[model samples]
Target chain A: MKIVVCMKPVPSSEARINIASDGRSIDPTDVEMVANPYDEYAVEEALRIKEARGEGEVIVLTVAAEAARSEIRKCLAMGVDRGVIVQDPALLGGDGIGTARVLAAVIRELEPELVLCGKLSIDVESDVVGIALAEYLDWPHVSLATKIEWPDGKMAKVQREIEGGAEIVEVSLPAVVTAEKGLNEPRYASLKGIMAAKRKPIEAVTPSVDAGQVGAAGAGVEIVAMNPPPARGGGKKFEGEIEEVVPQVVELLKSEAKIL
Target chain B: MAGRVLVFAEQRDGQCRKSVFEALGLAAQLGDEVHALLVGDAVASQAAELGAHGAQTVHTVEDERLARYWNEGYAAALAAAIDTVQPDLVLLIATVMGKDLLARVAARRNLAALTDCITLTENEGTFEAVKSMYGGKIFATIRAKRTPAIASLRPSAYPVPERQEAQPTVQALAVDLPAEQRARVVEVRKKEEGQIDVQEAEVIVSGGRGIKDPKNFEMIAGLAQVFGAAVGASRAAVDAGWIDHSHQVGQTGKTVSPKLYVAVGISGAIQHLAGMRTSQCILAINKDPDAPIFSIADYGIVGDLFKVVPALVAEVKKVQA
Candidate 1:
């Protein structure tokens, strides 16, 4: 079995995101970037599959800029066998199609039987690339999988998290699945794994697909403007007995919110 | 002339979900032709209902292959729907399933697709949608450059149309799905009996770490019971294993916009606030006056939840009686 883990770097959760003066993009300098937290789960799942199977190559794949090489190397440190980066500068901010177009090409080259990704990039929160890639490959795909079992070479049994319920889906091999949290606890890089990763090769490859078919020309959606969320007015607070505040709340609900 | 708007009718177990009607309302608001595409084994029963909610035409693709959600099957049919309609705008309800299928369809067509939009408005033949980014810290309004611009509305963020007894013309659309499917849902496990879906609930009563014990959630449950509301939990409570993940409402959990959200004992973090801030009314109950939740709440009470929650439940019951 072979596996490819797709990941993107996002600003560390603690880093404050500042909109650049250009008003169209984040000021990349102000924030420290890390592998997306969700992607850690994907990387870990790939490593675990290798451990369980006892023999396979796990490759870290990404469609990002030159800066992302270090991020991919971190996954390599976590015990992946190899790293592949699709380093076309133009692919930056490629809409889902643009991303799928690039990723699908590299995936075809790697020819991994399974591809895993974080459920969504924490930065853009688009949640599209993995499914779009699956579409391009015409493979079975599911998002938010809590549990998965590969019963045979051709199919994997998966329980996907849907609102109000869980859906158990059976997907054929060469399928795509995005990792939601709770899928697994990602392993920290061991001293041995880290040193081994330094010597391991990081391969740089560009998507051979036609750019016009993918990210070019905005891929359909345009970011017309960027702005911060409107500040909400400070609300009323009552410091007293629940008895005192209850009636006031009911009154306000009836008058202001109009739900009562 | 604004071009035709199209919505994909989302259904499960033969019942049309609320988001479809909301999508239809958006379609009606945006364009002259408000058409919807419905696919399933026997979904025609719900066509009249879609018609009542502003869909001028119901495009039905009834087939057994689509009875259960197979991503490829749904995507193929939806891509065909787009081709036939050649709509200027395409809308889908922002549900877990809707998000999964819409992106694939958009990708197959190489169309731009946006998800989790909270609000939208049209001007000069272009529609701009606003949604929070970075765990709700920032808001961005965006548009798609391509015709048949695709997007999904956050659940309950948009209004569903009022029921008017009107019949929409139902037309049959033929779509052929490939024989060998890549993925197919084989089983569905519903949440245990009588528990409401938090995002779909009109009323939500949530608890936080302050509940102190797993058993203490009963007080919060009592309040929810009083109002026939769903029970929700903060990330702290869930991370501590006091409640199930299904009950969690936050950035890492589920986003909900109930009509009335009663948040008890949660010291609101940005993650927790992002999920429920879109709710119509928020009532925050916490002992600390300085708790962050109070800032966004419509009403707040600074007191021990043990003393307050029972009393408030009784008060609500009294008013109802």
Candidate 2:
């Protein structure tokens, strides 16, 4: 079995984000980048499937700038057999649809049996790419998968998380499943895996599609302005007596805000 | 009218979400006829409710396969619905299922789609949607140029209007689900315990790594019980195994905006803020004065949660008594 996991490089959850002067995007300078947290689940699920089968390959693929090479290397260290980096100057500022188009092209070339991705990237939180890729590839897609089982070569059963409960779905082979956290615990890189990852193949490919063809231009949605939310003002400390503070706060909500 | 507003009434187990009614309230202001599309088995029962909530017409599609959502089936049905309606604007609740299915529909139709919108207003012929990015640190007003401008409104951002006493026209639409497109739904496994779903709760009390230990959540739950609120956890708490992912609120987990949101021992991260920032009244309790959650909270208590939460719960219970 050949399993391909699509991942994106995003700022580490710990990093502080500063909006650019334009107020449209984040400032990437000095921000430590890492694989999207949800993608980690996808990678770990792929690894688990490969281990269960005892014979398969897991390839990690990403579309990022040259600065993302080190992050891609981190995925290699995590036990992926190889990496594919789709780099292009025009790829910057591309929306979800643009990114999906590029990924579809890459998937066409690789033709993997199973595709996995994070349910949504933390950076955009759009969660569009996986479903979009499935549509472009004309393949069945499942989102928010918590558990997966391959009953046979042609069929895969997956447990999908819904609003109130989880539904078990059965789809044909050659499908896409977007993984969320808690799907599996991602393993840490072993000493042996880290050393071997240094020799893993990392290939770079340029998208053959143009910006206009893939609908990269003319973002229907444009960010008009952005600003930090207002700060919470100081509040009186009600440490001495509960009786004193309770009525005080209630009176404030009723008289000052008239909400009560 | 230049643009017709379309609302996707999201339903689970035959009940429509509050966000659906909220979307209709916004659509009523657009001066366009609001048409709602309901998909599921025996969903016609909901058409009257949708009509009372400002939808001029409710399109009902009854399919047992659609009762349990599969992205492909939902997307295909929605795409077909859109083709039939050809509306100028499309709106959905920014729930997990809506966001997942809308992406596929937008991609297939080559239309622009925006998610997590807190507000929507029209300018000229264009509809501008205000969305929070980088969690809630940055707010952006976005305008979609494409026809049938697509957006998913965050829950609780817009209030649900009182139902009007009007009998709306109900249309039953037939959607052909291709044999190859049918994905079998075998079973529905609910969370073992009957814990309230954080996303559907009207009130939520969440904790983070600041709580320090898993056992400390008892105090958090105590406060939540006073208000009949659901318990939530930040990514930090979930990552530390203090709670399950179903209780997690953030970009990766569930996005919820309840009427009242109380954060205990949570130092708000940007990702965490994105999930619940749109909540109506926010209260933050923490020992650290510098916790980011205080930034957006309407009420802040700078003290240990152990003392603050229990005291607050006691006061609430006394008031109720």
On lDDT, the leading prediction is: 1
Summarize candidate 1's per-residue lDDT along A68-128 as a digit string, tens digits.
Answer: 9889889888998888887776666767667887898889888999999888877777768
The TM-score of predicted model 2 comes to 0.92
Give the poorly placed runs of model 2, Cα more than 4 Å off: A239-260, B192-194, B269-278, B288-297, B302-304
* Cα lDDT of model 1 by residue, B69-155, tens digit: 877888878888889988987888888878998888887776668778888667787777887676665677777665667888887
- Name the lDDT of candidate 2: 0.79
* Lowest-sum lDDT 10-residue window in model 2 chain B: B132-141
Highest-TM-score candidate: 1
Q: List the residue pairs that clash in candidate 2.
A: none
In model 1 chain A, the worst 10-residue window by lDDT is: A213-222
- Each candidate structure's count of clashing pairs: 1, 0
| Regions of model 1 farther than 4 Å from truth | A214-218
Q: How many pairs of residues collide in model 2?
A: 0
Cα misplacement distance, residue A210 of candidate 1 (Å): 1.5
- Scoring model 2 with DockQ, what do you get? 0.53
Question: Listing every candidate in turn, what is its Cα RMSD in Å to the true structure after a full C-alpha superposition?
Answer: 2.2, 2.7
lDDT of 2 by residue, A1-260 (tens): 89899999987766667878888678888988888888899999999898888989998988888877787788788889999988776765566766887888898899898999998887766658888888888888888888898887468898887766788889786888899677999888888888989999999987677677354363555566666654444344443354455556545444553434
- The lDDT for every candidate, in the order shown, is 0.83, 0.79
